[model samples]
Target: MAATEATKAADDAYDVIVLGAGPTGENLADRAHAAGLSAVIVESELVGGECSYWACIPSKALLRPVTARSEARRVPGLSDAADVALDSSAVLAHRDAFAAYWKDDGQVRWLDSVGIDLVRGQARLAGPRRVVVDGGRVLSARHAVAVCTGSRAVLPNIPGLAQARPWTSRDATSAKKVPGRLVVVGGGVVGVEMATAWRALGASVTLLVRGDGLLPRMEPFAGHLVAESLAEAGVFLRTGVEVREVRREAPGGPVTVVLDSPPGPGGPGGTPSDEIIADELLIATGRAPRTEDLGLETVGLTPGSWLDVDDSCRVKGVTGGWLYGVGDVNHRALLTHQGKYQARIAGAAIAARARGVPILESDRWGAHTATADTLAVPQVVFSDPEAASVGLTAAAAERTGHRIRVVDQDLAAVAGASLYADGYRGRARMVVDLDREVLLGATFVGPGVGELLHSATVAVAGEVPIERLWHAVPAFPTISEVWLRLLEAYRG
Candidate 1:
């Protein structure tokens, strides 16, 4: 433990101290500074965080070269000239360029330009409104403290797996060399993407899905289509199988896995197990918040492996009311964009409290405010025949006590979607709140659907009426024209 002049001298001085300079934390600091509050950002890792270094940037970079070449090949006229093969060396180099090789000088310069103090070290809650950096330097806050540390992949309790060692999303995304044979132990978005990416790059890929289908959280039809797409891309999908054991074969040889099918409804549990062999084993199971070693208990807040926050993104327990949690750490919709939205709100609230202004929950330009989260949070999977979703599902809306109406359209039936790809087969589902005639949620699964998510997000977030949405026309001969077909179907 370490003491500072502020600990012995000043009681309260800092307006806001944002922890973890990820997209969310950076947004929080930016909003705090914009609110004219003294703010400092503490980050132990890369300033741009996982999204820049490993998750989004590098993964997307790995896909870009192939995606571009594939599109060119799809067009017969350009197919003759399109011989663009992925140069693994060049792709890795470009990804490194995008992430600045994990350097923070560019981000640091930007933060300094915005008048936000940048501190380097791990940070934890010392008290209600205080942060202890490196377990010593105490920075007392007058207003609020935001935690945006984000989440990491959860390791499963498979026997001998930990000892065997495995690759997570980080390792898979930033992989320098593509394995000759890759076995993915999850059928989630990340797993599917990695499988397809490496498969296209000439790696034999196998996917083991504990669930019955791909993207279990999405529409059942979407799962079917995505699974079909994966199969077409040469991904071997094994469903309803449990990984019994994982063991290293030789010093540098392929890893071997023992898998067993669960007891089915019609059978006794006496089935023999199967074996899978791969050069690399990647675990893309899921993610949990990084709440450990953060002194959550000291703040009177009960964090259950993940920090739980309210709709307004405030930590539950605290005596003097100084604790705030945002982003993946808060465990509310772990998307980076949603986290940033909450961070902006938390930052504004902190600045307002410091200035003696009433902290409002949803304002256009207040410190403590959120619009993009509770209303509509969008997510896009950057895989071939991309998947995108926003807002509440039909079931979720009904659970929330809203009578919902669903409108679904197939890509083959929509004019723009027909031209999107020569043989593009995809689906779009829309959940509407019948009482309000507003969109509860929208999901699109097809080629180039990621870009189409923002329009749905705006409609859901802005609460744009279905009638007004009709006036917002999509361009001709574009995939987005499906929006018109959706609106018409909804009206019908």
Candidate 2:
């Protein structure tokens, strides 16, 4: 809507207003509407946000086929349907289809169907309980206002990187053709994923990590296994390294990166040069919360440009309980699922308060919520053998003063794992809080383990006792049977 119309609409009081129409924002609106409260979601960009358009949905859609084909080749007995191939054109077509070609029509229809008002424009905090739309018109909320602004990929401040040109996760994931040689910076999930994806698509891939291993935040074994997996996939793992500088070199100009260390057997390992060149450079360092230009200072709500929220997702400095924040915008766990969880908790809490229900301060289901984020935040890497993990790491558990018992299992021993391939070498590790008799965290690294994560997620989130989890049966010949083996190993 235009600024005038937006202002006119904003002139009235809304019971709850959610800014950003990503999964978290949408979930917030849905839960609010379900509780019989009036809610509107304001979206400046695509309704489905980064996950739907670029980050998760499209990338996974592209990688799944390549993974399936690779699996079929590795496990010949399971597949009898002759030759398998991924049609590059069809893969791109499917990726576009998954994103609806960036169209918001389906999202709009869903919102209309669910009775949530849809506002299209930039939104910023206009007051303690109000938002300014498109930089002009203002909308005030009666109960709560939420910020679910998500995050943007961050490019590092490396010299000549911008002039030499580099692709962020956004650009690389949406490319039409794979480059001949792709150099990816940062050994986090995105870099590892793109490295494997493009390598499978005929690109020679080199992955650089500032740390000594891939996924440094995960357990050492998990990181080691993943780095090994990537290396086996023909990716050059340049860990514990730095890209000192970048410059365009040659006629067509490949970006030449000056490394901190030379490559040679005696001089430092691979090629004996202080520099390397590649057709494309991809920076997958990480992301920062999108909290700028939101007028956070208007209500004394600024905490170093990020809104400080309590357990209930309420903006800490906003008086009278008016302002709130959720999703990646809160600088909490940046996973999309975690964001949605916070939104639901916040929406429920706000809805109950509007009804004068005398809500509890930290009810498990309240708006000042996000209980799951603390214990059940899960992540899955979409690379060939896919890595999935939830909750705390072993070090994190120990740091928290928990008595921990760790059961780390190799995938090949599990009956279900052997069927995955003849030469399957994967890993699964669980950190159990012995004091609570519950799992504090879990990590699984292997093919087809993506779906297996939710079970562990529920176990950890629900605090399901390891003894009780034994009854959560798995069907025959399924990778899930690894759970039984895991429990057995834990028991032993």
Estimate every model's Cα lDDT from 0 to 1.
Answer: 0.78, 0.81
Best TM-score goes to which candidate?
2
lDDT of 2 by residue, 216-297 (tens): 7777776787788778879888876778899985544688887875455312456444677899999999787777777787
Tens digit per residue, CA lDDT, model 1, 326-400: 899876777877787888777766766677877655464334556566558788877777788898877778788
Separate clash counts for every candidate: 5, 6
- The TM-scores, one per candidate, come to 0.91, 0.92
Which stretches of candidate 2 lie above 4 Å from their native place? 1-12, 77-85, 249-253, 262-273, 362-368
lDDT of 1 at 150: 88
Report the CA-based lDDT of candidate 1 relative to the real structure.
0.78
- Residue 229 error, candidate 1, Å: 1.2
Worst 10 residues of 1 by lDDT: 1-10
